[model samples]
Target: MRESFYRYLMTKRDPNGIDEISHFANAAFFDQAFPKHSDDYHEISHYLELNATYLPSMSVFDEAWQGYLEEVI
Candidate 1:
């Protein structure tokens, strides 16, 4: 699930490369937080809220979560 979310984020990367900072930062956070496994949306959302400082906004994660759901479902 973590990798899927990361991949979803990558799909949103700006073509001109202006959003890479947030993109990579979120990826790194996901890597550290869920290195092995993570599939629960509430668990991931809560974790992000606890570490909100590391993200641009909850909407960014929400968008990725939506994308992840579309891909898997």
Candidate 2:
């Protein structure tokens, strides 16, 4: 699930543009945190809350999570 989410995030990155920096940064952080092996939203949210100091706001995560759900669910 983590791998899928990471790929989902990466897919948001613009190939010839710079509009998706947040997605790139979040993907990097997600890779580093190596978040739990669960797909539960709350569990991932808790993990991010605990370890995502680099994130400016949880809204970024929330956005990515929404997109991920749309893509995979």
Candidate 3:
């Protein structure tokens, strides 16, 4: 859920606005961001599922992971 929310913000909102999103995007924030009757989460989940086969590189659980460099002693 957290990852999905991050993706949503990065895609729809500003990519650098994650910190703000974390502060404002709770249950109430979700209710406000999406329409009251719209099933946005469900739709996003469904979109992932639907495109899972088409894009193996980008699946529902496939995150664009980056590893931090470790400092040598």
Candidate 4:
């Protein structure tokens, strides 16, 4: 799924030529990638923390999460 998403971002087939995968444009894709289920908020948080810890030298997860929250509002 991530690979497909990267391809989507790398491709320039969209009308606007923006390939970052906006939330609305890729709702189904994100829903599949990060499903809303289970009873483990802390577990998920820990998992994300682990990923953020090593995923990038400069983390943008916080900014991205803020943007996602703003979108929800």
Query: Judged by lDDT, which candidate is best?
Result: 2
Please provide TM-scores, in order, for all candidate models, with all chains considered together.
0.59, 0.63, 0.23, 0.33
Give the runs in model 2 whose Cα sits over 4 Å from its true position. Answer: 1-3, 13-31
Poorly placed runs, candidate 1 (over 4 Å): 1-16, 20-26, 29-31
Distance (Å) between predicted and true CA of 59, model 1?
A: 0.3
Look at candidate 1 and tell me the lDDT of residue 14: 57
Regions more than 4 Å wrong, model 3: 1-8, 11-39, 53-73
Worst 10 residues of 1 by lDDT: 1-10
- Write candidate 3's Cα lDDT for 1-73 as tens digits: 1233433433333434454323222322343333323224555445445643433333222232121011111
Q: What's each prediction's clash count?
A: 0, 0, 0, 0
Model 3 poorest 10 in a row by lDDT: 64-73
Report the Cα lDDT for residue 10, model 3. Answer: 35
- For model 2, which pairs clash? none
Per-residue lDDT tens digits of candidate 4, residues 14-68?
A: 4453433342234323334432332243543454465433334223334433444
lDDT of 1 by residue, 16-68 (tens): 55564457444544555652255567877787778556677788677667767
Which of the numbered candidates is closest to the native, going by highest TM-score? 2
Residue 63, candidate 3: how far off, in angstroms?
10
